[model samples]
Target: MSGTPATALDFPGEVVTQAHVRYVALPGVAGPLALVTLDNGLDHTRPSTFGPAGLRSLLAAADEIEAHTPAVSAVAVTGKPFIFSVGADLAFRSSLRDPEAARAGIHAIGELGHAALRRIGEGHFGGRKVPTFALVNGAAMGGGLEVALHCDYRALSSDVTALALPEVFLGLLPGWGGTQLLPNLVGADRAVTIAIENPLNQNRMLRAAQAFALGLADVLLEPADFLEEALRWAARVIRGEIDPAAARAPVRRGAVWA
Candidate 1:
């Protein structure tokens, strides 16, 4: 029997996932910064995962940011309390049986994710290059890290326990820009370790400090004050007080490692 195409497969009914937008002003930044929170109305244990509905919600939030009154000087994305986001809903993919169907499903997911995230990555909002930041307050894995990578700057909480691309471990690659963006940001060698070697080695994860040291995160702050600190940091970045280049500079690995 011919297998059903992924696009033809039925997705579960929309969940309660939605993006909540908050406008806050910092001392030095012009106008207010639009903070978009990804929430699923569940506890941290459940973790926020992206499905088609979730992606639509995020696109809507991006629209709202573009249309904000008084305008926004910057945009920032974070997760509820802890747990930034665990990435795409694996259950959606698991439902596919045919290889072609699986490829179709993955393609749809990638297109939607890139469409939404690219808006943030290019800093395109209201026809302007609005600075974007990711406040990674907790576990950010797979697509979650990719989302953070899309942002111009990233801030991680001191308690983040899982930050990595574990797709290889599950017989997948970083489909959503991870393969392209990571190497450019962290260099070819480190990217190999993160995208290939690490996953094969029992899917090693990075702590907050390690992520920062690897140039994956711009700053690390205590979980207690992470959001506030991220906002302050965003203000500095918006005001041109911090150099984006220096903030994104890759760490120099010693020759011993090579």
Candidate 2:
């Protein structure tokens, strides 16, 4: 459990993929909020790159989170180093030993992530009665971006941290609710524009202000104040100082799908 898997190469300062997930409860004014940290310990790509095994581990990790979360009002730790998540591991996926197996595996993993997305975004977890937040300290692309969008609100870094959906370049669409989630967070126009545009041509990097303006990001803070800001924001909601219910905006129907 303390070492890397035999199938993986030995690398220094790398995030081991075995049990590469963890969860904890945050002490809030109302009750403890669940805080799950995704730790593929990846120096290159995300755990979503590992195919079926990775998907299984991710679902199992969510189960672990539920075990601790008998109560609601959860927030993800997008605030730490290697914070948030970096989408799928394209490098590793392209290197699959068997293309057929890899394709099937990617489909399965996408399904798993989509289900998890419904839980987080639709409020299935935390009783669907509590607000969830994703404190995105770093970049979140593809599935990672969808994860952040699954929450009611997002706290992003003021740095060059990006939030993108680049699934089109893969000869695939966003299967992990990214297409659905992005529109919900940002407006249909921006979301559809992003999806329609070629990711290979766009950087998709959003500064805190840009993220805030687009409504995809709720608040922006310096790296130093990021965690404090998120906690404070969540605490306010817990304390009845702010209206969390007024936060969500329905995704407008757009030309792409309809």
TM-score of each: 0.89, 0.75
Backbone clashes under 3 angstroms, per model: 0, 2
Give the runs in model 2 whose Cα sits over 4 Å from its true position. Answer: 1-28, 42-54, 97-99, 125-128, 198-204, 244-258
Report residue 135 deviation for candidate 2 (angstroms): 0.5
Per-residue lDDT of model 2, residues 113-224, tens digit only: 5655555455444445566777787767677777777777777777735566777766778777777667766667877656657465653455557767767776667777
Best by TM-score: 1
RMSD of 2: 5.6
Candidate 2 displacement at residue 115 in angstroms: 2.9
| Candidate of highest lDDT | 1
After TM-score superposition, the amount by which residue 117's alpha carbon in candidate 2 deviates from its true location, in angstroms, is: 3.3
**How does candidate 2 score on lDDT?**
0.59
